[model samples]
Target: MITCQDILELQLDGVELIAGEEGLDHPVTWTYMVQTRPFAEHMNQGNFALCVIDYVRYDFEEAQRAMEELYELGISGFAVSVMEDREWIPQKMIDRANELALPLFYIRWEGASFVDIAQSVGKIILEHEIQNKRTGDYLYNLLFGYDINDRYIEKISSQFGINFTNPCRVGIIVADRRYGINLEQDEHIYEYYANYLN
Candidate 1:
């Protein structure tokens, strides 16, 4: 549930907003900093991509293309550091980002460290993960009767967003090792297992 707006509110190292105001609400699941080529293929949905254009001379055209490619790859936003040439990012790139509604940020290389931004975003992601794990553990305990009571069940279920009124069933499956069937190799394994359970 961490969004670009949350990062902006952090006011990380006085980071400046460049464009894409409409995408402030876009959800960010993770943050990645890249200075190398071929970045988009490695990214995931809801990723916040940070471009470090650190070379003595930078190619604005390639940077623009990469931004568009990252946006198409489903990134929530993009951040870039100022080039060595002292040129603010080009107006066309800002216009393109605005047109695409992909949030853009300008963090000067001297003004902020990548570690600072990463740590701030990483904290939010880690907290969400920890909360999810806690919810899962609570559900497991309740289902297995670690503490079984109407009050406890209702409270725990609501906390984890589980609707107890809905009919539910628990299932367990033991895979046979003798067959040497690799689930990854066999597309039919899921159907076979379902048929066996039924």
Candidate 2:
């Protein structure tokens, strides 16, 4: 999974983790540039939010409230750009983020642009998805390839780091339409289950 730690490794200019170091493993499914209040309503779980401290008007109370709301919403992490004059995030906000284990990041106002951070994160996510698709294709071929042979199986298994010698079982999922489910909306859930099963 693409995670907060992975984003940190990109080392975008002037961005640093300030609190909740233990939460660096939080999976980041998407990134958002937040510039408005009540932004939590537009966010979803696994979202990494980026914004300026101006979102809270540099008020400690507003910052606290925003962090609390983001935590409750399962936001993966937060990155706030501090204005030159301010130069710091509120201590109370940092304390609250540690308590919630929600990774909090700091960005120098004149450092990385929000667009750059968002695009970098987006690229990482896309690359991860592409790799997953390629792995899936390899597995599909293993299951159905007409010319399967010991050498071919060994090559595929070694390439993907799978232990082909281990006992394995296959499962079949049959979806019923009696309840009229929204396939599009539930597609991610299916992917989650597939990964879990694998």
Candidate 3:
């Protein structure tokens, strides 16, 4: 659940918030560069739309409309680059953003480009998703015997740098619920077990 606030922590240069400060905590599902397409098919809940602002630079109404449309689709937020000596973001756009509680920000892009921001954010999200998938698979296998074949086992072991030939054992540690082991604690325990097995 990486949120706009998480992305902001990266402190990208030239990027500034124009409105919707309250929406910073909303979780971002993915980041994508905006294109001419309608964006309905590509947009999903928690999407962060990144744009160059070239298309709506001259039209304030269009920019406001675009923000409203994106908000309707459950987009997490929007990021736009405001190049030097170019048109600035419209006040209406900022107003609409605050009204909708959608996070909106402008990137100065002094030397950095929109692609750089998109790539960095996308990479963080991609890695998070991959880690989550691996966790889910590992938990599933642990709870329900290894329902996979040998080939699958070999692949998993190779990916995780585990040697199948070595002695392996699974230890189930039961925690007292009264002690209140949170999810973060569980992950640490899992990690400890994984390292111990290796």
Best to worst by TM-score, what's the order?
A: 2, 1, 3
**Worst lDDT 10-window in candidate 1:** 185-194
Per-residue error for 70 in candidate 1, Å, reads 1.2
lDDT, residue 111, model 1: 78
Give the TM-score comparing model 3 with the true structure, all chains together: 0.65
88-131 per-residue lDDT for model 3 (tens digits) = 78777788889888889888757457777777788887776676
Q: Which candidate comes out best when scored by lDDT?
A: 2
Q: Give per-candidate clash totals.
A: 0, 0, 1
Using TM-score, give the best candidate's number. 2
Off by over 4 Å in 3: 55-58, 146-198
Task: Give all candidate RMSDs, comma-separated.
Answer: 8.0, 3.5, 12.5
Candidate 1, residues 1-198, lDDT tens digits: the string is 678998898898848788999999987877876555566445666778888665543367777877887787788999988654367888999999999888999988677777888888989867765766677577667658654878877886787777779787867776553433454324334433433343
| Model 2 clashing-pair count | 0
User: For each candidate, what TM-score against the reference?
Assistant: 0.69, 0.81, 0.65
